[model samples]
Target: MTGIGAKALQTRWFVRSPIPLFRAGLGFVFGGRLLLLQHLGRTSGQPRYVALETVERPATDRIIIASGFGAKAQWYRNLQADPHCRVWIGFDRNRAAIARTLTREESAAVLSRYRREHPKAYAQLASVIEEATELSIDDIPYVELHLS
Candidate 1:
C-alpha cells in the first residue's frame, strides 16, 4: 500500500471508539517509538492529538517536527498561538511542555535524523517537509516536550 494510505488507515483506527485501548495498543507497538502530541485549539480551546515519530537530543529531551500533512492542519497553527502542550509517550501522559518552534537549521537536522532512522515513513513525508521547510517557524511549529 502507499504510505499515505497506510497512515490514513492507522489514523482511522486510532481515533475510533474505545479510545483508551487503541491508544494503549499504539503505545505498546510504537510508544517512545512515536511522540503523541496534544494541542489546544487556538480559539475553541478544544484538544487535538496526533502521533509523530520522536527524536531525542543528547540531553534526552523529546523533539517532534511539524511537517504537517497539508500545511494547513489546525493543530500546527494552534501550537503557533500557544506553545504549551501535552505529550504522551507509551501510555504515560506528560501534561507540562512548552513548544519551541525550531529554526530552519534545527528542523533540517531533526528531519535528517528522522529520515535516517525511519526511511519508509520519512519517504512519505518528503513532500510535506519540502513545503514546511520554507515556512516561518510560527507556521511549522516544532516542539520539544519537556517531561517534568
Candidate 2:
C-alpha cells in the first residue's frame, strides 16, 4: 500500500486499534517481536501507549525500536523530553527503562543488520514509513531501550 492508502493506514485511523489491546495488557500475544510502550505525552503530560515492532534485542536487557516517522513522532519526541518510559515485551514488563536515541551511523548499521535478518519486514516497514513521512527509510530514527 502506498500514497493515500498507506498514509491513511499509517495515521491514527489504522494505528489506534492495537493501542487498546496493548493497553489491556495483551501485547504478549504479538510475541516478543513487538512491544507496548507506555510513555508520557509530550504536551499533555499524560500517559500514552503505542505498539512498536522490535528491530532487535541485541542483548538480554536491551531492545531497539525504529521510529519510522522520524523525529516528528510524538513518542520519539516524548522520549527525548524524558528518557523514562515503560515497555512490555511478551509476558515481561519493565516498569522503568532508559531510552536513548541512536546516532545516524548507529542507526544505519542497525537497520542494515535488520534488513539482512528480516528482509520482508524491513521492506514492508520501509514502505509504510516512506509513504507516511515522505522520506527515505534511512532517515527513520532508531531508539535503544535499556531495561533494568
Candidate 3:
C-alpha cells in the first residue's frame, strides 16, 4: 500500500492480466484463492470478466469476495444489475452462479472469518484497500457468489 494508489488499482493491464489465464481454464494456479467472475455488462449486456481475490469459501458452493473499490466497482455494479453469472475457481470453470451483496452484518461476519483464517493476507489486503479507497474493511461491500 505504500506506493499503490487509486490510479494503480484502476490500471487495466495490472489488474486484468490474470483474466486470460482464468479464461484458459488455468484458474487452479491460483490455489482457490482467486476467481474469475463472468458477468453481463450492465448496459451492454455483453459478457464481462474480472479476476477477484477470494475472501472466503465458507461452503463448497459459495465464495465471498470483497469489493475493495466499494459499491462503485464496475463488476459489483454489473452484478447488482443482474445477479446471474458464472464463476471460475480452482479447477472449476463456467459454473453457473448468482451474486448477492451481503448485508452489513453478514459482511462483518465474513470479514471476521477471513481475518482469522488468513491473517497475513487480510492485513495486506486491508492496507492496500485502505490506501486505494480510503475506506475501512468494515465499510467495504462484500458479495457472495452462490454457485450452482
- Candidate topping TM-score: 3
Candidate 3 lDDT by residue in tens digits, 37-85: 9999999999999999898888999999989988889999999999999
- The TM-scores of all predictions, comma-separated, are 0.66, 0.88, 0.93
Query: Which digits, one per residue and each the tens of the lDDT, describe model 2 over residues 22-119?
Result: 66778778888888888899788998888887999999789999887778889999999988999888878755799999999999999999899989
Check candidate 3 and list the clashing pairs: none
- Candidate with the greatest lDDT versus the true structure: 3
Q: On residues 1-148, what C-alpha lDDT tens digit does candidate 1 reach at each position?
A: 3445445534656534334543565554554666667789999888877666565543445556564533466667787788788876666655467777677677777767777887877675554344434443234545556555
- Please tell me which model should have the higher lDDT, number 2 or number 3: 3
Tally clashing residue pairs in candidate 2. Answer: 0
Worst 10 residues of 3 by lDDT: 1-10
TM-score of model 3 vs. true structure: 0.93
Off by over 4 Å in 1: 3-19, 22-26, 55-59, 127-141
Number of the candidate with higher lDDT, 1 or 2: 2
| Candidate ordering by lDDT (highest first) | 3, 2, 1
Q: Give per-model CA RMSD.
A: 4.8, 1.9, 1.5
Question: lDDT per prediction?
Answer: 0.60, 0.84, 0.90
RMSD of 1: 4.8
